[model samples]
Target: MLTQEQISAYNEDGYVKIEGLFTPDEVEELGSEMIKIIGDWGEETIGWRGPWREKYLAEDEQQATKAVLMHNPHFYSATWGHVMFNEKLVGCVQDLIGSSVQWHHTVLHAKPPERGTPFPMHQDYPFYPHDGLDFVDCLLHLDDTPLESGSLCVVPGSHKDGGLEHIMGPDTAPHLPTDVYHPDKVESIPIPAKAGDVIFFSYCTIHWSNVNRTDKWRRSVRFGYHDSAMRPVGRYEDKVESIPIPAKAGDVIFFSYCTIHWSNVNRTDKWRRSVRFGYHDSAMRPVGRYEDDPYRIDPNNVLEGNTNTIVSGYKTNSEAN
Candidate 1:
């Protein structure tokens, strides 16, 4: 589905653009179906509405925030659902993250000519906070997006910084402070894309867009897919530092269940055995069961109706829903 080189690029740079991910026919279908699903709305009904509007625009250019947008297009059109379920796209994503990924949400961002909105630097973590860094957003372009036509710009390798602080309060959209991280202020790169191309980017990467100065509409459909087995840091705070503790046999490690942690894949064909169990205080009561619960899945036993001499700790997150 994806080359190892492509996967490596995403791991190192936080983003990768795949050209011709969809065919020309597929792109046309998406654009036409989107029109049908939205129908027609008066100009007054459309515009970007975020508190950062004033900080990024002038009195005259305030209307530039008049970008067109909608959420969950798949809810309205089966065509979108079909595209979301594209086999190559999903398999490529699995190659990067893991075997299991879930749909977080979908969005339609249609930038109108001249008055299209500009998204300031921001990390998507604030919009949909999750437990792991395996969360990825896929953008399907239906128009040729040049730098001036709100092409996405990203800070390379920034996801390694993990989540960053954003201005979040009542009635405000979460975004980085303009004074510190606007396009002109931050180190960035514009990702110009052709119709039918798809851009896969991490949720933690700092991203923003320019206004659509072109005459045509810059349309894109975005689907957010996340690994069910996500592992990341902070309840709501940005990452500070990471420490790796290498161990040998006979080593014991202890950590809070709340900590977002994962073990490297077992590379050997032979069994890599370990005994894992959790202990809690007598006063504590269990309310939720996670994916790796011992009670739900006995590590020592083979799957139901199967015979196995050794227990292989391979996991799969393969679900259409």
Candidate 2:
């Protein structure tokens, strides 16, 4: 569970980091499972996007294309399932989300050293906006990350502005206007973290990162979570903020979904690998397929032993009010 001080930091700055929440063994095991699944990705698993394989395929490349973030590892891998439903991980989220959580979605983001592409500044709300700012994303660090390794950068308190206007950039991703979000006004800050550390932030937070200039790979996993009553308010025109909540290997950080943040490209020669997962409040939200599906316990339940916190929550749709 998060301390009052840590929760205050999140409420005040839009993000907070909790140190050493996971054990070193658990972290190492997750890394191993990720490697096994990554080794098996091919035409059958990668879907279309054949050019991604032809144009950028390296002997040691992480994915077929940078655009393809691997989804639902837990569905195929038991190892991921354990990490996904880890009690400590879910309990912390329960405290912030204010109800029992539901499994949302997970994505794996890996950046190979030296050639990892740069992710531009953007907001996730444009694609997956929900009622108020109940959505949150956590970055689970799988390797040591430093500013030189293209760590995350974020704009503090930017989520309070609500959803800011954005436009599609050359890459077809929705992004803020560079002129208006200038460094002078937005104050981009780099957040460095270690393996097992996690950084949670809001969906509306405006943020971005720089290219990694180190010789090692900077990798981490991300999990998106939401309250039980939250639902999608919009779709990706495409989609994706902030704070430097740093931690050592085995720690997890939680933040509001609207916090503005981003990261740089890995310039190092090491591989940066990370897996992503998510939890949601299922009573009023969908369980992957449909919106009205009844919430199920056990198997994927994160609130297994922590039932006192469960409660019947808010809207199942935007028009409910």
Candidate 3:
């Protein structure tokens, strides 16, 4: 439900792709409730508990669930807080962050099979910074991301060069300076997506991903939205070409938060899942790390409420799960 040339191609090529919204039985009941919270044909059927508890292990548990990465599964799945309050993705977040929207928190990048993991190229305001970029990352691709199975890559406008300063290499987290992606300074585009597609972007857009050399297993879920009045322009900077639009599954991508993206590494054997969730703008307020758990997936506070109200001090790796 957006067109003015898709809002002027998300304001001069930032990002935009909306095709199926969510059907196929709501993307097969949100991929069978994320395979019962990432059990993937093994065990761990739901019993959802989070707080990242050492990524939940009870033994080998398939080698501790391939280093599980599941933060805020709607705070322990009420079928993922009912698919993270999807009313056509909050009416496209009130048509791109306008009327009352707050509820920022949701992650479930469950990249399993063939041990998936390879997100570099950084910029989400250095781990969710805020204030001026007005945040908005809604990447839910739940599978069919090809490019040898690791699809998603960009550099189009490069968010007009904003946030580009992430040091310390080899993904111990803080990243960016890989000589600022030297392909003669930058030009990487591999945006393949399917299975319930959704790829909105920003957070000063520079993106990354690689290493799924597919054998089956690729998941996504990044829903994060903002604009209530914006806050947290703290600063710490660093930061697409190529928009291969071929959506299917449940298409919906709307970029802005400083667009520049990345993804590639699923060497295919099949299996790529995803499901992320987030929204905020209900008169803003609660800054940094959502000011102590300010979870609010609207629908009148979906699964519960937490308009915490803490102004600064941050921390969110799903608040350690």
Candidate 4:
């Protein structure tokens, strides 16, 4: 159960880190399980793009390893409605989002050293069709995460606001215009953790991470949950779809669909492994495509034109520019 102080902190800052939430032994077991899964997928490239396309078929073993890491097994018996829905986790989620939360999805992010890339700032719900309101996310750490390694950075209270407009950049969103968002911003707070520690934040919270400059690899497992009332924006893809993975250890970061978040690249010479899960409010309703409504601003992205911005240290990826 969460203490009054913990609850208060969450309410005030929009996020909280619970230390020593999981034992070292548990972290190790989960890591080993991930390694086994990666091995099973064989040598293949991993990421949003296809791993075994014609160009990558002849790459070295390292390239193959990268490919295989992205081929996560969504229905793996290890995660199938079991480990993710355990009583302890569920109970805590119930406390935050109410007893009616439902499972949404899961993702396993594995970043090999010198291979992971930086993830830009963006809201999780923007990609989905759900309405942005009253949702929560739970992130579980499976390894020790430090500043040198990639750790999550969040803008306290950004969630209470709404989404910001993003100008696409050359490498990211080249066609977009500049002078899109207003200036003064909030700073992002870095939340580091050891194995077993969990961090929970709302979907509307704005957050990002830094690159792993250390030689040691960083890894984590994240699970997201939301109110069931949110409608699905598109087809139900695998819970563990490929996005930019994080490079750190014992870092579990979860959020709701409406939450704004991102991660950094792994420049160090190590492997970053993490798993992720998504859930929804049991009472959420389905909404169709969000693009149709021009007057309706996505609460998750309300910071676009505001000059006084919070969490200004981290920038969105080039695509989000």
Ten contiguous residues minimizing lDDT sum, candidate 3: 45-54
> Candidate 1: lDDT of 240?
49
Kindly report which residue stretches of model 4 are placed more than 4 angstroms away from their true locations once superposed.
42-74, 77-81, 166-186, 233-321
Candidate 2 yields a Cα-based lDDT of 0.63
What are the root-mean-square deviations of the candidates from the true structure over C-alphas? 15.8, 18.8, 25.4, 21.7
| Candidate achieving the largest TM-score | 1
Model 3: per-residue Cα lDDT over 1-321, one tens digit each:
666676566555565656567666777777778777776423322222232222223333423334346666754456667665688775666666566665576777755665454455656777767756656677777677787655667676676677777764342465566654633366767677887878776667776665466788777787787776775545535321356554567776666534676555333344456554444444444323333465733333333236433333473434422
In model 4, the Cα lDDT at residue 309 comes to 26
TM-score of each: 0.69, 0.63, 0.26, 0.58
Writing each residue's lDDT as its tens digit, candidate 1 over 1-321 gives 889999999999999999998999988888899878767531322354566777777877865456667887765666776766688788778888998877677888888887688888899988887777889999889999988898999999999998889988766668998788887777999999999999999999999887788898898888889997764445646654667776778888888887877665343344557687666553333343345774574444433322222222342223211
Candidate 2, number of clashes: 54
**Candidate 2 per-residue lDDT over residues 224-297, each given as its tens digit:** 78887776666644434234554566665554454566664343444455554444463433213233555533
Which regions of candidate 3 fall more than 4 Å away from where they truly are?
7-9, 12-20, 41-67, 70-138, 141-158, 175-199, 202-321
- Where model 2 places Cα greater than 4 Å from the true spot, the runs are 42-68, 169-171, 182-185, 235-321
Q: Give me the candidate number with maximum lDDT.
A: 1
